[model samples]
Target: MKRREAREKAVQTLFQLDRTEMSIDEAITYIIESPIDPFYERLVKGTVNHKEEIDKTLEDKLEHWSLERLPKIERTVLRLAVYELLFEDEIPHSVVLNEAVELCKRFGDEKSGRFVNGVLSKFEQK
Candidate 1:
């Protein structure tokens, strides 16, 4: 699968894992029907594996809202993007940020994209 597709699925899978008790494997299977794509799995697994660090990074970036207070979609998108930004050096920062905004626009509310960009731009600037 393409990186874009994998990112969208990773956001969805991460969203599922966030909202439920589902394991990573269960979340992956629920979202992706075909053989597991490495990129998608990496996004989900890497995010889960380093969630505490990701959340801490997010916690520091959030203005007034706490990480838990953010919408689930936004929270998951941030986690996935942060995972890429922090660990996946193969992808450019701009691509990760742009894809994150697109994911928010596609799966989240009208303001989700703007919110994601605002938070992630801080990381980009650092």
Candidate 2:
């Protein structure tokens, strides 16, 4: 799968895991139709594995908004982007940030892209 496709799937799977309390294995299977792609597996597992740290980082960076107070789509997109930013060293920071903004634009509300870009820029600066 293309990385963009993997990212979208990752966000969907993560959203499922968050909202339904589904197991990682179940979430992956539910979202991905083909045999498991390695990139997809890594994103979903990595995000799940590091969610606490990611959430803490996001909590600290968000202006006045708590992570929990964000909409579910925005929260899930941020979690996936943050996972890529912190864990996926093979991908450039700029690429990750750009992809995240694209994903937000596609999956979230009109302001999501800007909101995602602003939050991720803080990570890029760090």
Candidate 3:
């Protein structure tokens, strides 16, 4: 799968996991209709594995918004982008940022793309 598609899948899977109590594997299976790619698996697992730390980093960067208060789509997009920014060194930061903004535009509210861009810019500084 293309990295963008993988990122989309990862966001969907992560969003499902966030709303439910499903395990990562279960969440992936539940959402994915086709065979899974390694990149897809990696994004979901990596984001989930480091979620506590990622959330802490996000909470620090958010202006007045708690992570929980953010919409699910925005939160999921941020989690996936933050995972790539912090852990996946093979991908460029700009690419990660752009993809995140795209995901927000596609899935989140009207302001979500800018909100994601602003929040992720803070993470890039660290």
For residues 14-105, what per-residue lDDT tens digits would candidate 1 score against the true structure? 98899688998988898999788998888899999999999999899999999879989999999999999999988888898899999998
Winner by lDDT: 1
lDDT tens string, model 3, 1-126?
A: 898888988998999999688999899998786678999999999999999999998999999999989988999999999999999988888888899999987788669999999998876533
lDDT of 1: 0.90
Model 3 accuracy (lDDT, Cα): 0.90
Model 2 local distance difference test score: 0.89
TM-score of each candidate? 0.95, 0.94, 0.93
* Shift in Å, residue 11, candidate 2: 0.8
- Once fitted onto the true fold, the runs of candidate 2 whose alpha carbons sit more than 4 angstroms away are none
* Model 2 lDDT tens row, 8-120: 88998999999676899998999887689999999999999999999999998899899979998889999998988888888888998899888888888769988988998
Off by over 4 Å in 1: none
